[model samples]
Target: MEIRPIVTDEDHAAALREIDRLWGVEPGTPGGDRFDVLVTLVQAYEERRWPMPKLDPVEHIIGHMDLTGRTQADLAKLLGSRSRASEVLNRKRALTVEMIHKLQSEWGIPAELLIRPYKLDAA
Candidate 1:
């Protein structure tokens, strides 16, 4: 059980191979223990090497609308104004608390997602 930190890509590859060899081993045994540690190390290395980008609130809203077959006009109805919906979608305005509440209540969009700070268009 000569496990090492996954530093370089070569090290990562080696750990993966070892993990494959140790796969399906009985838990609480030597091989299974090694497998667990290696998997954790590999996961950490992958996260650092290829971190995921945070979801943009507007993009999430658009994606949700697409998935649910909702349109901009539908969003306007929810927001009480077509111009306000356009402004929010176009990054011309930030989502207000009332807008967030409406989205959460009516559209099931999570408030936390909508609350995240996002870039706005320069004036």
Candidate 2:
């Protein structure tokens, strides 16, 4: 079985096709081994060439609110102030480290996502 690093888009496409062919192959067989290798190669290529962008912090908060049926009041309670929640949601103020800690601990929002660099409004 000949296999190579997935470098270009064409190589990636080829690997996907091979994966499709290998999809039903039984494990502990040659086809299954090839499938495993090809999947690994394709994943590495995609991660290098088309990595997912980090979530925007404010957008992440808003999306989490929508997903979890949370409201501004919930955020205020988490952050310890309605005004602080408003400013944070409006992108007018930066989130303090403490706020990040609380949001992660209490609300289960990931600290890494919450800690991304975000712009604050001009004074």
Q: Which residue pairs in candidate 2 have backbone atoms (N, alpha carbon, C) closer than 3 angstroms, thus clashing?
A: none
* lDDT string, candidate 2, 70-104, tens digits: 99999998988899999999989898899889878
TM-score of 1: 0.59
Off by over 4 Å in 2: 18-37, 66-69
- Candidate 1, backbone clash total: 0
Task: State candidate 2's TM-score.
Answer: 0.65
lDDT per residue for candidate 1 within 27-119, as digits (tens), equals 999888889999999999999999978888899899899999999999999998999999999999999999999989999999999999999
Q: Give the per-residue Cα lDDT of candidate 1 at 92.
A: 94
Best candidate, TM-score: 2
Worst 10 residues of 2 by lDDT: 1-10
The residue-level lDDT of candidate 2 at 2 comes to 60
